[model samples]
Target chain A: MATTMITTLDRSSRAAARGLSDISIRNLFIIPTILFLIVFNIFPLIYSLGYSFTDFRASTSAAANFVGLQNYRDLLSDPYVWSNFAITAKYVIISVAGQLLVGFGVAMLLNRDIPLKGLLTTLLLLPMMLSMAVVGLFWKLLYDPSFGIINYALGLGTFEWLSNPKMALYAVALTDIWMWSPFVMLLSLAGLSAVPKHLYEAAAIDRAGPFYTFFRITLPLVAPILMIAVIFRTMEAFKTFDLAYILTSQPTAELISIRLYKMAFQEWQTGRSCALAYIVLIMVLAITNIYVKYLNKVKER
Target chain B: MRKTMTSLLAGIGLVLACGTSVYAQEKELTIFWAEWDPANYLQELGNEYEKETGVKITVETTPWPDFQTKAFTEFNAHGDAYDMVVGDSQWLGAGSTGGHYVDLTDFFNKHKVGEVMAPATVKYYAEYPGGSSKYWAIPLEGDAVGWSYRKDWFEDPKEKEAFKAKYGYDLDVPKDWKALRDIAEFFHRPDQKKYGIAIYTDNSYDAMAMGFENALFSFGGELGDYKTYKVDGFINSDKAIAALDAYKELYKFTPPGWAKSFFVEDNQAITENLAAMSMNYFAFFPSLINEASNPNAKNTGFFANPPGPNGDQFAALGGQGISIVSYSQKQEEATKFLEWFIKDETQKKWAALGGYTCSAAVLKSPEFQNATPYNKAFYETMFKVKDFWAVPEYAELLQQLNQRIYPYMIGGEGTAKETLDALAADWNATFKKYGRGQ
Candidate 1:
């Protein structure tokens, strides 16, 4: 009876294989996904690209005219657009630097044998998990001059964290770092835990100084993953909007995304905003490519 | 196989029947407006309408900052999503020019809407320009930037004596900008955690425009040559500089974070007794009156904006009008609802229900005049209103003011004169973009 059942199952399997070719089965599985991508993603991307070359106001019913690079030229020459780019660059640098420092520092500290390690790591990662809008609102309350607990704890005499333009951008950067450093921390923690214990042992036998051991062994081992984390964070920081928009109203804190929003929605300059968005995308892609190349080089070494 | 096919066909038939029945059961009409206290009243009224007509009315609201963008996005897509919209007065130009709103000229004539509401309301809120005959909306809510002060503090004997000794004048509602400044200086008690006034300076939203425009207007500063859209001399005039200087000077007496203050923060200051006075919308006065715990509830005093050196007093118009979206599928139902909403009886109920209806019958009623402590002030300020340009490019122009004036006044970045000069240049460029430049 067992032999008969086995022979029947093998016969069905052979029949199924003959019914559907491997290539046809593969195509059947992937066609829906490919169609979805074309309909939702590629269509809008190409449609918006076409609009970027026109004089189109999204809020109006007037027909779009092919202005042939006017929108791009205007954006490139606009001082206000340049100012927004400058602000975004400054914010990206400050926020990413702060995240890398705090994240790497915490990861190194946690690399040792510690009590309540899992619970502590989970609590530290909470900020990164919360919604950005919720985090923005929470930080706004914390930065309030009259009622915030931060001011009370610091005993600073009425510091306007999100009000003063001089301090507003930095205040927003601080919020970003607080929320996202845990992301870097998680990634670094993974890389740190994966490093071979034998390498550290070898360094110890050589009587390498702490800094030398870190710079030579641990860092090289972690560089590729660290570069990956940096690249991810750099792209996110450059597109930062919610925290900056919700926390501070100061022009000094306006990022490229916020400026793009104002141009697209507020001013109804649809074509110009599309052009601005594409410019930002290209810049981010270039930066990411550079980081990726370095990351590949690090992996090779 | 036959039974399975029959069941599948039955399921499809059931779904179609249910869909058709659901569609026919209720006629839905949606009204889009900003999220505010009045939305609850509108929802209540919508519920009442449903009870009377068997038509469901849905009131959808977005935050004030997002309302314009959301409405425009919906309208620009030419979707029959919204039956009616309560949009900002500045939206009139864009809505009319872009054909987003139904041209209410014929409806206005048929209903005599111009004769029903106050002339100023009809002209400013309904018409594209001040006196344009083409009506695009019906005035639903009347509002303007007005002043409110702590009457108890001003009337306190010790405080009054101190104010008199310091300013050489009695502590009273300021009639002019100078008196207002002096009052602010007198009551300024930052050491005791008390601020003189709470004024909005945030670059984020319309706070800066609402808070500063009145002062600029009072000082005889014109935003532009309204007819020609010329902005150079008017926005950067010496008088404008003086007005901005006076406006910024009050920052010394405001709270530490007042530079980023909007309506919520300003109201918080007044209710918390952190600030002795507040500049806010009259539409918000009812909320102030309802704050039982706040000293302002019992001792609030309202005043129209103080006059300038030239004795010119003006209030920045802060209100919205209701209009029919051109693309609404339920246009007839929405129009019926509007007809009911603007009726004399309904208008009275609208005011009583916490909506600031602009119906002349309601405004002239004794009940409406004495409805709240600030009601009379609301009436007075509505008549003295000055509005910004109601053009398609209003947002761009307003942004220029926010970017320049906010940095100078709130961030302490540049001189008032320098800020206004830069703003003038920017406005000129913006006007030129729209083909309105001189």
Candidate 2:
């Protein structure tokens, strides 16, 4: 009786597949997703690329005219744009360097057998989980000269952090490191925990120094994943906007993304801002490509 | 047959009644504005409107930092999230040019919105395109940058004698810009944790520009030709340079950490008694004047902006106007709401609730001038206040002003003349992009 039932079910399934071919079934399942991506993602990118060549302002009803790369030329030639780029690069270097040092160091400390490891990791990860705007705002209050806890604890006696143009960019970078170091630590922890125990045993037996052992064994194994973290963070820092915008308005702190935002939304120079965005995208992609190539090289070794 | 006809008439009457009830239920409105003291009062006034007319009012507000971005985002999308908006005065230029606001010229005139409000408010907050007679908004609130000071300290005999001995004059409300600086310098004692003044230094928006304009107008300098949009000679004139220098000099006397201060910081400087005087918008004075909120409310007094060397005085305008959004589907209802809002009785209630109404009757009345300590100063400043360029290119102009002035004011980057020359060049370039100048 069971055999008869199994045969009957198999016959019904075969009957259902009789009309539709495998290719048709696959298309039925995949067409909607492909259409969604093309419509929402690709279309806007192409449309904006078209606008980058025009003199269109989103704020006005004036008709767009084909300026034929005038926006790109103007952006490239502008000294102010270059300054914004330089500021962003400085911010990325400081913020990413701080994150790498703090995050890797924390991961190394946590790699040992420890109590409350899950809870400890969760507490450290809280900063990265909160909204960027919220974090920026809280840090702003923390950096306030008159009432902030930072001044109170350090006994700096009304020392200016965000208000000082020379220090404002670094102040924001410090906050960025505070907020994002946990992200790197989480990734680094995953890589740290995966290393074989026998290597450490061998290094211990050989009396290899901590630094030498790290440089030779642990680093080689973790370098590929670490590169992945660096690539993601570098790209993100290049596109930083809300945190910098909320924390400081000093021209010294203005990143390229903030400049792009001012042009697109504040000044309503839609076409020019689009051109600026393309420039940033190309730069980020180029840098990311280099990092990815190095990451594959490490993986091969 | 007669019974059937009677029943049919009864059914039709019931259907009509149901439709009327549904219409009343749908009479809802939303007005977008910056989150501030006035927005709270506006909500209270809106509650009264709802009570009287059965039309529910929803007041949506965002923080001042992102208010402009929020409004522009909605306008760019042409969304109907708000039926009306209490937008900044300078926004009239962009709103009308971009067709974001309804053409309210006929309604404004028909309702006599101009005749009922102060003349300056009507001109600055309502009209666009200079003398073209186009109106986009109704003057909802009136404000200006005015001075607030420690009245108790000024009245003290010891302080008076000390100030007089040092400045060689009576220690009283400043009569001119020189006296103002003198008073600031007198009160400046950083060792005691007591500073002289709190002024706008924030580079985020128009804070620094507005603070500097007070000196510029009084010093007999202009931003440029308001009619023809010229900037080179006027903006970088010797007098303009003097005004820029004067503002920078005042920044020296403020508390050490006020380099990025604005209205909120200025208010804190006063309430915390950290400064002897501060500059802030009159719209924010209600909190400073309310005894419940501020411990030194009674001791804090208001004063008009001081005159310059030539005895010329003008305050920077800080107000907004109400307009029906063009994308709203409830235009007629929103129009009805405005007609009711600008009435004498409603405006009186608005002022009583701490909402600064532009109604001449409400502002000039003895009860209003004497209502709060700051009310009288607000009334006086409204008449003499000067507004920035309310042209279609205001955003670009402000962005450039912030960049040029911030470095010099905060970072102490260059000489005053050099900074002004760079600002003039920036303005010229912006205007040139708009096909206005060579």
Candidate 3:
């Protein structure tokens, strides 16, 4: 009786209210968001797109002149820029592969009924929650050649991790993996939980081996979410800057993002940095297209 | 009618100037500087300034690693966040050309800054184009590359005999680069875990470049002509190659895994008893001199950059000049602060408070020279300082040098001649891109 009275009163109130119609109210909510995006995001995108065609120095108040693809041409032909791209690719592959293996392996262990499961999972996830810069600093101390715990613990005896040009990139990728693996683990865990118990019971009754059951049932079921996690991680790993920057200064660890940062901010080559950014963006989009196709295949299965 | 119009315009101009001066008397003023001991001392001076004047003065600082980035970000945005910046000498080119700093040519002459400060300091730190009347900054912190050594080991009779027997020299402070190398080799005993000198090898920013500049200047090599910005043949000259070879030779005797060591690591090598000698800035020598901060303080001795083969000595200029930001609204008040700051009495107090003052009056005083073990060396270094290009494109030049020089210097990526050739080409291309090269 009370609900009916409230519904009756709300209908009467709406009829009496003339401040805004439903369409107007909807627009009121949506228009500000559209305006905000246009002002903050779209405007910068358009502005930078224009700048990418010019010779602009942000540090100076001089007028920019249009160079008409000169920045792009120069970057495309630059050997050091190519080297940076190659370094970035190596870092992504190493970091993403490591993250997937470690994350899925841990998730497999946690999928089973375990003691203090929540606490164990929380502790494992701690590294992912910490600031990347902070983690890099701690790792630097750990990797120090003299009196570092890693050298002492493993008897590597003063192995240079960050300073060694041959090992610096891999060392940085390893730190990236250590920090991000738990993200993949969490996604994998969710997928594992969602796998129906009846399907496992069905496989057990059929006398399917553990490997067979996992391959036929678990693997196919979790593939979509696994692909999603991979897509997210690969994109982020491609643009990794903080870990690589803070952990090492070796040329081997100079990823493209770091180059972009140096160009845009340090070198103050605003126009060229914008052009190079567009190049990275195009590459990211191409990779995303390939990932999306794979995701579609997983969905079809 | 013409006189009436001129008088009317003059009256308006005078009123606008008065209006700006009135606006400049703001309640507070802020300075941007790197978070170092000098900045702290500057803050103490700021406190004194606050007491003298009604306006509050705040010294905002960032760590050395990100100081340039922070300053440039603010400058790029044309922000009025800082009234003054105690910025690196190299930044004058960018700061002046970009209009980040107010041109102080007239003010400099009016205040007679060049007449009172060290001539080299005025050349490297204040004047953007060496020997020019144009000025954008005041030589504030006068610094140069200096060294500290293990004095206890040097004084050991057995070590002295062994050094004299092996290298035909006494185990004392080296007077030249050749003797320095000899001393380094004498102490480079790997099995005993004691290494040679520690120097800048960190690839980031200007560490390695600054380290190499010591050798470069000593051997009488130049990167290029600063005026013309021409770098093709000069950087690849025989003398430059030899200087680079000398630096790499010195690197061979350093402690293992020092491919990325900088001042902090150099200091650690001395305090941790791992190195016999170390090169660092005079700004950082106080830590090694403080017996509480450094365990090896009592056994440490300081020296300036030694002479080269021809008895020519020059150290990389590693100091900052204070400049007023063009965007700042408190220019009048900032000018007042700087005017008071450069006074003889003020600079004396600055030195007393551990702020490195470039004032000729203070540095020449016997009392100031004897105040610290490194003071005399610092005084000597001030006269023989040289700086890199202070062009607006210096970041590009410095970064390129760092990227090319590091792998070769630390890792032996290529021959010195080849490395220098590659750098010369890189620099030539860079200069052309900036439209400075012929």
What overall lDDT, based on C-alpha atoms, would model 2 receive against the true structure? 0.90
CAPRI class assigned to model 2: medium
Measured by DockQ, the strongest candidate is 1
lDDT of each: 0.86, 0.90, 0.90
Total clashing pairs for each candidate: 0, 0, 0
User: By descending TM-score, how would the candidates be arranged?
Assistant: 1, 3, 2
lDDT of 2 by residue, B4-83 (tens): 79999999999999977855657899999999989989999999999998899989999997898899889988998899
Which TM-score value belongs to model 1? 0.95
- List DockQ for all candidates: 0.70, 0.55, 0.58
Instruction: Please give, for residues B312-401, the per-residue lDDT of candidate 3 as tens digits.
Output: 899998999999999998899999999999999999999999988999989999999999999999999999988888888888888889
Clashing residue pairs in candidate 2 (N, C-alpha, C atoms within 3 angstroms): none
Worst-scoring 10-residue span by lDDT in model 1 chain A:
A2-11
lDDT of 1: 0.86
List candidate 3 stretches off by more than 4 Å.
A1-21, B1-25
* Residues B270-317 of candidate 1: C-alpha lDDT, one tens digit per residue: 789887788888877777777574656877778889899999988899
> Higher lDDT: candidate 1 or 3?
3
Give interface RMSD, every candidate, in order: 1.2, 1.5, 1.3
Q: How does model 1 do on interface RMSD, in angstroms?
A: 1.2
